[model samples]
Target: MSTTVTQQPQHSTLGEYKRWLRVSLYTILLLTGQCTATLLGRFYFAKGGKSKWIATSVQSAGFPILIPLLFYSSKSTNHDFSKPKRSVMITFYLGFGLLMIAMDFLYSCGLSYLSLSTFALVCATQLAFNGVATYFLNSQKFTALILNSIVVLTMSVILIALNTESEDSTDLPKEKRLIGLFCALAASATFALQHSLLQFYFEKVAKTGVFSVLLRLNFYPMIIASVGAVVGLVGSGDWRSMGMEMKEFEYGNLELTITPILAVFVFHDKIYAVKIVAFFLAIWGFLSYIYQHYLDDQMANQDRSDDGLQVLKGEEQI
Candidate 1:
């Protein structure tokens, strides 16, 4: 008689759970930070603060927040992350830092003119930009759902562009509104490129471990960007006007306009039918991309489970 027995690997399940838990935590943190930062950044411009460089500086200058998290070591894993030479690391970090400065500066320009609602809607195109970057850079599969997302997002942009005159989010002129649109789109594209470069660096060059990820990908580059922002601030002499800008600005709610809905009440941003349509389209596109990502994650986990089962079966062989 022949008998076969198998034992499930409990460790694999635990590890997968931990990985997902970490991912969830990171996602929540990122979302919170983005909303908070956007609200405050837009607030700066809303109150007649004109220095784009200062706003740009504040974005990356908050690198100190990551210090404790970055330094906290965790137990080692089987994955051996690459450790590039210091000089090489410097070059890589500087490249990203410069790119980030330009990205932030453009975003600042966008916020300076566009209302919070309009700005947020434009920012939604960021994911669409990432989709394009992934298609070209990683050669990721062009699935139907993802294509739908990209097309829908493009339509959202067109919706806004078509009704340029009546979509008055702010008291700004049509020319300034157009400028905001351009700046926001440019910033989105720049951010997509930055994201692609970061992924490429981690996957191909750095192979940085999860624990040390922020140090190279964000901390170093942000420090360099902060310096660039400061230099621009001083060089442009915008720092001189900041004192009066802050003093003369009319003060209002601190956390009032955290979203587009709130912007109607807080910033008095006008709502147009076209913008309403665009917002819905943007939301649909965003949801489509998120669903596609969820599907991708499911497939990845299933493959990992299959590999783990194969290993466990081999080990249990009689």
Candidate 2:
């Protein structure tokens, strides 16, 4: 008689869970970093800080800081980071980098000319533009939920825009206000397009660890954006403006350092009901808008059918 031996597949449920936990933690940290960076950039521009190029370059600093984290994570997972790295095309990166630089410059200009509140309201339009860009770039289908979300979000932004217009009792000059409005719209569109392009690259081009992918996505663009900023800084003679920005850097930099810890706490506490509700409401509003459009289309079709029947009956009578 002969005996046979079989090997069972190894299960690593705990290992998988640990990986998930790490990814979640890192995601929270990144989000917090993004919030802080945005707030700091906005605050700096709001206070008459004229070094838009420097501000843009500072925001790109987050990318390099994450490189080591990504490398370690990849190593822990036994990923072959040494493999020939697949990346987005150079042409795409160059074009995307230019767009990012333009968007940042426009956003800085808008912040300089407009109040923070107004600029924020205008920035919300990016969500709507994102939908359109995703549809075109990523072949994202417009399901009812997505359509609803877009509609509601757009309506909310429009209401905010109207409110800002009504409350235009500010000391800002008309020319500045108009320029700010144009810059805000342009910035929103460019940002949405850039985001869409990034989504495409991540989905199609990148073949690396998550950290590596993110680092690559941000690092090269940061270099390009830094170059643009340096050119602008020299061209505008705003190199001296850095001193003023640094003097008031406490306003935003401190928040950047603190927010990551606060974000961790918020993630652990689960005290986010209000934000959840608001998010759902936006989705609900979008759904209703899409449903309404659907109904209107149906009604128009019915009216055309009725007209056709009447025309047929008149022809029979004649």
Candidate 3:
């Protein structure tokens, strides 16, 4: 008698390894996309004279797409919009959006003088600012570990900023460096305040379906920014001038790199090796945060499972 060996259907350890590998690989790609978008935004702003028009036009085109995405995500998550919390939710969204627009505009104004790398390094102080702000806001308790992390994060930012400036000629005036420092500090404050406000909204009002909350929050500021752009054009008597300028300006089709990257290569930064290292450091820091969050979630799930097992054993004993 010939016996047939039956193969059990199961995911091998290699399969699990591949699943994690894919997740990590996708995370890096997502980070790359975020970093590229951030770099390109500064590049466009730095290009000055007419690139503002390009930024404004691109933002306008992208705004409409978010609305459909918002609705779809909300539906997928089974979010109830008619829950009678509309008034509070709308207020929170508007407040958050307005705050973001104000902060962003201020940062943009400051960027006319600061280098992209300088701004990125300076922005690294956000963790410190957030910790201090959270303490004052009474939104979260700050532990010694949190305090130490903030101090270290702040020191690293200061060192990075100083190093960048020192590499510039010593003969360079003090006022410019001072202005950069001040702008960076102010930017950090704005960033921290925005975070505090957002945390409050997320915890209190818009708890379900974060994507829907993001959609509602984004919609108002987007409208405000569009209006601001139009007013800026008309106020400067450059509405006609902008149109004429757009004719000569070449906005490239959506590609791997936006128009700004090409502009940076051609007209602005050379993208040094050191800056590449800093960029990687920033990306690593962000990924570390995501990893920590995943760990916390897993712990919570394990606790819930243990609680359920204890309850089952008690019921079986009875």
Candidate 4:
């Protein structure tokens, strides 16, 4: 009669709880990282850090920090680094590096000219740019919802721009305001294009373990960007400006470091909706835009099929 009472482990429930906790932590970290980067960029710009190249160089420094992680990851994972040839990789990185130089330069110029709040608000239009860029670059389908999002987002930016026109409240000069507006729009466009291109490369070219891809993506670009930044700094004779920029650089650096971690580890993606209709409208617009693109693609394919059928009929008649 030596039957002992045994307790079963609640492994499934415990594992689920751990998973939920991890997701929550990751979400918070990502939000924090994004906010930190934004604030730091604004701070650097507001603090008279006008040299875009120098600021870009400082931001690019984060890539080097990943060297150890990249090495460790390569050692630990069975990743094939030889898939993308060195020359091809260099070309890709150089192209993107040049684009990034322009984008960062425009962003810096915008920040220097516009108030932080105005610049940030204008930058929000990047989503619309992204929508268009993705459609062209990746053949991303645009649905009605996506269109709605783009419209709403674009309207919001327009409203902000209109409000900024009434310069009674601020001391910014008209010329500077105009320049800032142009720079912000240009930056958004370039950023959207670059983002779309990056996504394309990540999906098609970076067909390896995440670490190997990240290393190639970040490190090589940094080299070109660093060179560009150095030349800009030297050309502008603003080598001394880097010290002030570095003072506020830590926040941006922290953001850069945390972003990749969140991207890799975070599993549960959540969108918390507010009571604002604009927010919902933007979300729906994005959905619609994507759907519309899909519809366009389907229509194009159908047209191609019809053309092929007509060609076959003509051949038969002949």
RMSDs, each prediction?
Answer: 4.0, 14.3, 6.9, 12.7
Against the true structure, what is each candidate's TM-score?
0.86, 0.62, 0.67, 0.66
Error of 1 at 50 (Å): 1.6
Off by over 4 Å in 1: 1-18, 74-81, 165-167, 252-265, 312-318
Local error of candidate 3 at residue 133 (angstroms): 4.0
lDDT of each: 0.81, 0.63, 0.58, 0.67
In order of listing, the candidates' clash counts read: 0, 2, 0, 27
Candidate 3 structure, TM-score to reference: 0.67
* lDDT by residue for model 3 (1-318), tens: 011111211333355478779988998996686466556656554433343433443443356767778768767765554342767766665666556555555554444446666566667666667777877773566655565556555555555555542432212355665565566678678879877877766665565445666676767667665666566556657566655554544553334554556565553444555555555555554444445446655676567657756766677678
Question: After superposing candidate 4, which stretches have Cα over 4 Å from the reference?
Answer: 1-31, 48-50, 80-82, 164-170, 240-318
lDDT of 4: 0.67
Ranking by TM-score: 1, 3, 4, 2
Write candidate 4's Cα lDDT for 1-318 as tens digits. Answer: 112111212443476479769977997997687556555565555444567666566656567787887788778877544467777778889998888778777877776676555665567677789888998988886766666767887775655555532552225687777788789889999989988988888777765547667676777777777788778888887887666655654344344755534433322212222213334545555566556655765687567657756766677678
- Which whole-number lDDT from 0 to 100 does residue 60 have in model 4? 62
Tens digits of lDDT, candidate 1, 11-102: 65688799889999999999988877788888777766678898899899889888776656423433466677788788889999999999
In Å, residue 74's CA in model 3 sits off its true spot by 6.3
Better of 2 and 3 by lDDT: 2
Which candidate would rank higher by lDDT, 1 or 3?
Answer: 1
Model 2 bad stretches (over 4 Å): 1-31, 70-88, 164-170, 207-210, 240-318
TM-score of 2: 0.62
